[model samples]
Target: MSTSIEELLRFEEERPPDGEAERQGWLRPVLRILAGAVAIVAVALVALRTVGLQVSIPVLAAGALAVLGVRRVTAALSPPPPPAGGGRIGGGEEEGLYNWGARDALNAAVKRWETPLDWSASRPERFASTVLPRLAELADERLRQRHGTTRESDPARARELLGERLTAFLDNPPRRPPSPRDLAVIVAELEKI
Candidate 1:
């Protein structure tokens, strides 16, 4: 006897979403602040009791609010991660793409920063200062030896190498700088040599 086709197709359990990770950006911090405030208030209440001051319910509430406010302010001031699926080479695998993969990783890492390389500095400078300099220094000292014996060198090649990928980065080139991820990808590609 054999099972019907429909029965065979039945799944024992539902599958998870395919790596569609919703970056816990705003919401996660908000929740953390809330939790911290509650904890601080609980401590403050105990402290007030020890000091013999009548723990006013309103005062306790205000303390809780203060903690939340402080936390929110901190979170807002902190930086955010790079956009999702920005530098991914393959479907979802972040490894084995070699230089491409490394570039993808570098771009991803740099993006998780607050102040990035000043795009206004020009492509060459941005590359020289951020990506090229570092990779050239790392992989081999003489690869671009004429450019610079050390890591610091012109960023033009990096920018040029980026080509189309630099569209979003160099478009403004001033206020909005290229994220760390962009520089990283460029560096990774350069390093693979």
Candidate 2:
């Protein structure tokens, strides 16, 4: 059997009956506060019995006040939360709700580019398998768009147009990470192609 779109989109929460919900709205907080008060009072009474009542009561009160003071001071010292949708440092501006995957991918790419030595050392297979294929594809796409042929279709002409550095890198990517200047030159040559 099939379900209607309306059924799928409908709110699925199992809400309590109106009367029960209203009863619980006030009841839960009241019960919680009452329980906490009972616990505090029990502790206070134990202190009073252990020491003399006057000394114990004042000491308990002072302890409670100190806790409150420390909490307030800590709260004041702590930094406020970032405004919603505010991007983090070195990251791009936040996109609405479900863009975390895109942001994460972008951040990972940036990190990979930022540390070429580590990336090449740690993931040498990715360098040859992933990066080379992508660069080759880009070069082929440019050649096809501008000259009506790809590297495979017309290697001699494509290599001349693509230039020595880019052609060599695409044909056989180096085992060591290329310097930023070398990469930039290759990218510039690809754009020219």
Q: Give each prediction's root-mean-square deviation over alpha carbons.
A: 18.5, 22.8
CA error at residue 29 for candidate 1, angstroms: 2.1
TM-score winner = 2
Mark the regions of model 2 whose C-alpha exceeds 4 Å error after superposition: 1-118
Q: Write model 1 residue lDDT over 1-63, tens digit each, in one string.
A: 989999998878856545434456566766877777778778888888899987877778787
For model 1, the run of ten residues with the poorest summed lDDT: 167-176
lDDT of 2 by residue, 82-123 (tens): 557754444554433433433344455567768654445467
What's the number of clashes in each of the models? Answer: 9, 0
What lDDT does the true structure give each of the candidates?
A: 0.55, 0.71
Q: Which pairs clash in the backbone of model 1?
A: 103-185, 107-181, 110-180, 111-181, 120-173, 124-155, 124-156, 128-155, 133-151
State, as a TM-score between 0 and 1, how close model 2 is to the true structure: 0.38
